[model samples]
Target: MALLPSTRAITSSAQALDLIPIVNSITSLLQALNPRNPNPKNLSSSPLNRFSPFLDPNLVTIVITKQTNPFHALFFFNWASNPNPNPKNYTHSLRCYEAITNLLLHHSLFYPAINLLKKSQKLSDFFIGKIIKAYGDEGNIKAAIFWFNQAKAIEKDKYLYSFNSILGVLVKANTIDLLRTLFDNVVKEGGFQPDVSSYTILIRGLCKKGMIESAQKVFDEMPCKPNSFTFNTLINGFCKKGDMESARGKVDEAKTVMSEMWLNGVKANAATHLNILKGLCIAGRSAEAIEYFRWMASCNMDLDAKSYIVVVNEYCKLRKIDEAVSLLNGMCGRGISLNVISFNSLFRTLVELNELHRAILLLLQMPQIGCSPNYVSYCTVVCSLCRTEGRMREAGYLVDDMLRNGIGLDATMYGCLLEGYSEAGNEEMAMQVFKEMIGKSYVIGLESFSVFVKMLCSKGMIVKAENFFEDICRTFPAVERDGYRKILDEHQQITQGSIKEHQGEESS
Candidate 1:
């Protein structure tokens, strides 16, 4: 006896229910609908398409109203909102905002999902606070403020996001007047309570902008006691401004706050120590800075390259070249690599002391230590070579090394070589360098060309100097031609006077 058609269909539907869950296990499958995908053809024959009749809005509304497990209903609603296939009637049909908002209202990932929606330009200003909070978390207060302004422009009713975002950005930017204006506007408009983070950012900004008294007033007037981040920010700000007394006071306040019920978890770190050391160094308190650097080392805080470079620069500036070198050598011994800035500092000091050979040696070590000489480093060594006796060959070798290393030789390098040759009484070599400079299309500014011309005129080669001057005028059309004309007139006067004097002497 064969089964009836209706009985066969009921049994088939029961079997299909077991396969539906397996098919729906794929998460966020809508992302596969991108036009770039090559396989929408595969989805055309999918079993999921057979359930299309059950995905109507009325069915979804019934599920939402009658289902005991709202989670499953919510998932269905989300899927209904973001349909599997574009409707044959419409070009675009996905309700991205409705789906995201539904997820936001019911999901654990409310903030992140809202942010994803905002990034897609699908979220509205109703979620502005959440968006602002997201931006603040990412340290993008400026972007937060921009979006807040956009929201305000779109809708006249100001929200908390508008106040907080503007205040946060102004505080971060340290625009005191802008922050005050925003604060006053928020207060006048009413119903916006400034958070601790807002106050902390403002206090930090004020102290950073050198308004310690104003910062203190804000600190004192806060509704709640200050947290460690607040105190730490102020302390760091004071340290940056070289106000050690205020910095110490803030440190004490941070200690007090940490001991109390609040535990702000923000204590002084390497940045704080480094800032204090810099302030000390600037005040000519090298001994104290060195002591602090040592103390930080004792605490196992790894000193950054800039910290070492700053101390090295201070030593060099004070004419303590040996001390600078010793510090650099000590840093190298400790497996702390020197950066290009530090290496260049030491090289410059050695060059200043007329120790060209030692400077050259240090320069060679630069590549081994992963420090490459920038333009300043090359210029420094070249200038030192030009000044030192019998270093012309070395200077030429340095120039070759620069070219080999792919470091460009600009007008300064050419100028240095030209001046060196002129000073050495090698006028022909100088002319050759000038020609090379022109051939290479280097920017030979008026000052360098004028120097070269003066060198030629001094050697009684007035015609060559005039020709060089004319070539320069042609190259730089915007340059005032009067300066070059003056040089030409002077050369002519000198030449004519010399010839007349010679003729008179011969006649006599």
Candidate 2:
């Protein structure tokens, strides 16, 4: 018998199996397995069970005949590929692995499915390249580099494709040193010419890292002159670095080059406009940021989440709380969803303005907008509440709420609550919170202990304050010890001045 059957015979056999009908029938059968079936007994007696033999191991040959739907074919291929003691079936495992990888790559489920195969210790440089590409999609260059190294170590033969994938990842990650080392290796050992894509990735990464000078040098040295993307990346880099003069010059250069080349119809994209706006914001030119925002609106360019965030932060930084709030509300009115960074910025501004009520309301509104309060949001609100007069109870409630929602309370949050109780003249409650912090093995910082000691001394608990001060002095660094000593000196000065004032009054 031939090692492989002819295509005609395989096609005739597949048609005889009527794969489409079989898939439909299987799908229906799986659907009927639900728990809400009205007549359970009828399902129990259905004819689907008679076809249960179709799922049997001995029926592998028959299952292969019915391979059609990619998912269903994968299911059968997996069944055929199971490790069997029989030596004759070893080739089936290779076919099954190839089939599964192809199906997953086609559907873009490359990373997860490749991970599943890796557990079986069966992957080659080809499979590793696919995995690296998937990691690149997720912007996870570290994981891509790790897998690339693994592939190189195991593959006996040096594959240039593997080097290219890793180099691209490193460039995307802005790992300039790694990129240079790999580039040298590629040239020395892999003997592959660097492509335009490779050079572009490095230039873009350098630009993103604010190494504009190096990026420009790379651009100048490119054997194949630069393209528009290369220019755009450089311009965006300069804008990000707040070198607007250079950014604008690059833009003008691009236009000049395009005109000279007679390459019309190519212009800046949304990112180009957004970068300019961001640069203006970072340079504290809020008026310019707003002007560019309006320009973007007039040009009908879709404003992104970051565009709104930049304007909101700029307004907040200038202490224009009302304007920031108005912008946030306007963004919602325009259906521009706020992400975590935007919400955190707004929350911090509210905290700084001592608008605890509004900050609390914002925290409550996060989940409604499909945003959850992260650690930063929780910490901001907690710190604000701690600073509020007569709001120790509310601060306590928020801490408990954070814990209940599985947001692990950190040492700083615990310290804030302790300080809140102490400031509110509830020393006992403060002690309780301190005990909780100690139980969690959190190293209490010097500033925190200093606050506690001052609170204790104010309440005429000098001995306890001295003991706590001693503990802090022992644990803290030299710089922190000096800070604690300053607090202690201030406390002593206040005490002595009070005694002198009392004596003078008595003598009078």
Candidate 3:
């Protein structure tokens, strides 16, 4: 049914409408209606009494629809219908109920919507389905089950949608045990039969929790046929598990399903191909995975950023830098924007392969390719180069470049430079970096702090080390004190033992 014009108008209004007074009016009415309030005087002074002249049920419903918070509507509904309600003026029409209920659901006010349903004088499949969905959305498996059981008393047709909603909630919650029981109940019940969607939900939950065999069992036992989403869920589940054997098995299974889909005139789309590609990558079959990726390009399948990233990461893992770069160029030519993640993958691989120069080249080229390098991109190369012989100076230059580009030098970057300087025995530069880092927002990581302290001690600058340790204790009082305690204990033990030896010598 189409919405009322007034109802539609209020919801689309862009202004931030205030409903606090309306809510206050209704809540006050509720309190006055309560018999327990002994001092129930001045009913005429209540806001409801004052607004009664303008409180048309239809008009108030429009206001309810406009309210951002559903509680306001619930309070308004209660006030309208609860106290000495006039049949002609105060009755909540079906349209009014639907409006408020939908508004409640839109705001994710599940409990209020459910309460509305329970108190509703009229119940329908729509309201029941909404209640079940609301509970599911709340991630309240127990509440969803309670409502499902409550729905059993509802008519069979009404219960059907609510039942499916509950099952879907179970699937989302990964309540496998409850899912099994609910699936059994649907079967054991005389009239209701589980639909493809119902089975898909159960299968997806199983697959997600790594129950591949059980998911397959449910797939095989399906009385109805499965759709692409059903197949995709299982395929993606296997890939995410990262178990090579199972991933391979699932890949073959997915291929079989795709073949069946083709025979049935259901064409495999990009998502279908992407799932298989992900599985192949997880199985470490990079060669086969690239073949599929190429096939996608040949078929003109639209490849998204994720698809590019998956292929890029797989190629990087196999140390196929040239192939990965080709994919990046191909994406650019095809008008696909490369995200930071794909670039980072290439950066990581280059650094790992000890191709620091190549990694730096790519990092510099990132902005030209429309992908700005993030902190990780710069830090990965800088830290890697800092570990190499005679490359500390270059790493320091990269940090300056990062700052010139308006990318702030974070704690990790500072830590990297400090370690590099200390390792290179450039004590002056190390102390400079340490001083600049002391009061910054980025708290240095514990390991880096330890390295800085040890570097000072190893340089025979004991007084400087002591002062630095005192600064640390003052600056990061919350830092784990064990490192400080160990250092202090060692120094104390040396002093005490020397004093005892000196006393013994004096006695001799």
Candidate 4:
């Protein structure tokens, strides 16, 4: 449990420099180190002997944390644990144990975790909560409760860890009522003190269950100040419940907290602004959301991609394609990496407005923007091109592009293509598409079938249409057959009326 001596950090440097890259390099070496060393205590026999000069607690912890293979992590942990290159012998710190133990438990390496904890004299009640939470994370509430009870019998005053872990377990299980009962009992007993985490878990449960008022009450009653996470939770809960007035109130409170944090020289979590943007969007005040987003962009708050996408989606929903594109271009100018969601928003809006030309251009330009067009991007424009007259050729090109890109078509895309072809009087292409659909067992829906039959009859292909119907209509579901019969019957009536008009013209 003693601090491992840093790499002759015993000595000083002339100027301050970043050693993180060097530490990362050493960690990579340890991660790639073989676990089956014949001499586990000696680093000179292995490739890591070179890094012994750089070995420190920080590097050791990083090495253990980075290894996905627990046995490999254990090997490095063992090799680092040995007293080497130092007259003042030191061992792995408690923080190293936490890092390794967490990694082991994350991978369900329980037996090894227990062994490490016991060997390091860390197998105590304080560490038991981690085990409890691990079970809860895997959705095993019963096992979590068992551990909680085990901790319960050991120490009365130090049961707070077990209590907080159980609260989180109950929250995950959606057992809000039982969690509240336990919370109430704990408070009444007053055997232990509950920390910010305890209150946050209870508030999270209440918020999830739509008990916002109760969550707020707990927030107001909390002895400790709420963290950003606590405020974000309450704000999100109100937003989910469509109580933006309350959400905005919390957002204002969060702003004040952020201001105080700023004055205190604490960097505010950039997500604070993101929560406000989402709340504004949920309240249908997208204009305000856009304004807020622009303000965040201008500031040094350092918001992430999601903040831009949220505003981009809002702009799309408002049919403000120009503003959305402008925001995206601005993001590109700032060297912010964009995902397909940013481009897809534009594609979808353009398609909705019958702007296939613009949509197609955007789809092609996606790769140029350093982002690949996803299925939604191609499907949106391709489906729109199919809807417009004389655009099926372009749709086919896009479909070929999709095939080249290895994107498979879903039934929705197929049906949309069929509808688009039928509506454009491209019956030959429609029929070929139908043949493929039939081969794939993709049944044509009522709307697309009606469009197909109408296109056939309107083009004077009556006999071919009749034969196609008599054969295919029977194969359709009985309900769809009935609907098709009515459609055929109405078209027949219209055709007979047209024949009578032709005869009257001859008589005249």
| Top candidate, metric TM-score | 3
The residue-by-residue lDDT of candidate 4 on 1-508, one tens digit each, is 1233365564443133245555566556655554553235544425545556555677678777777677677777766777355433646788888888898889887677877777777765667788888989999888888888877776656788888989999999999999999899888888887888899899989989988788978987888777767766665665553566766555555455456546645455666667768877877777888888878877867777888899999999999999988888877887889879888888888888988888887787877877888888888888778777889888988898888888988777888788888888888888887777766766677677777777777777777667766656555545467776787767767777888898999999
Worst 10 residues of 2 by lDDT: 1-10
Cα-based lDDT at residue 213, candidate 2: 79
Ranking by lDDT: 4, 3, 2, 1
Which of candidates 1 and 3 is the stronger one according to TM-score? 3
Give the alpha carbon lDDT tens digit for every residue of 205-257 in model 3: 88777887888788878888788777776666656645677777778777776
Evaluate all candidate structures by whole-model CA lDDT and list the values in order.
Answer: 0.63, 0.66, 0.73, 0.76
> lDDT per residue, candidate 2, 1-508, as tens digits?
1122233443323235434444455544444443232123443324343333233332343443344334444443443344333334433444456556655655566554676577667677777776777677678787788888787687745544666677667776668787877776766664446666667777777776767778878877877655557656665665665455665545444334335333534476666667667666655667877877877878878787788888888887887878877777777777888677877888888888888888888887877766778889889988888878888787777777788879998888888877788788788987787767766766676667767766777776777766666655555444466777677777767766777898999999
Count of backbone clashes, every candidate in sequence: 0, 0, 0, 0
Q: Which stretches of candidate 1 lie over 4 Å from their true place?
A: 1-164, 171-174, 184-192, 224-228, 241-266, 333-337, 387-390, 440-443, 458-460, 491-508
Between prediction 1 and prediction 4, the one with superior TM-score is 4
Residue pairs with backbone overlap in model 3: none
TM-score, prediction 2: 0.60
Residue pairs in collision within model 4: none
> In model 2, what is the error at residue 407, expressed in angstroms?
3.5
Badly placed stretches (over 4 Å) of model 3 are 1-108, 118-123, 237-240, 400-411, 441-447, 457-460, 478-482, 485-508
For model 2, state the Cα shift of residue 245 in Å: 7.9
TM-score of each: 0.65, 0.60, 0.75, 0.72
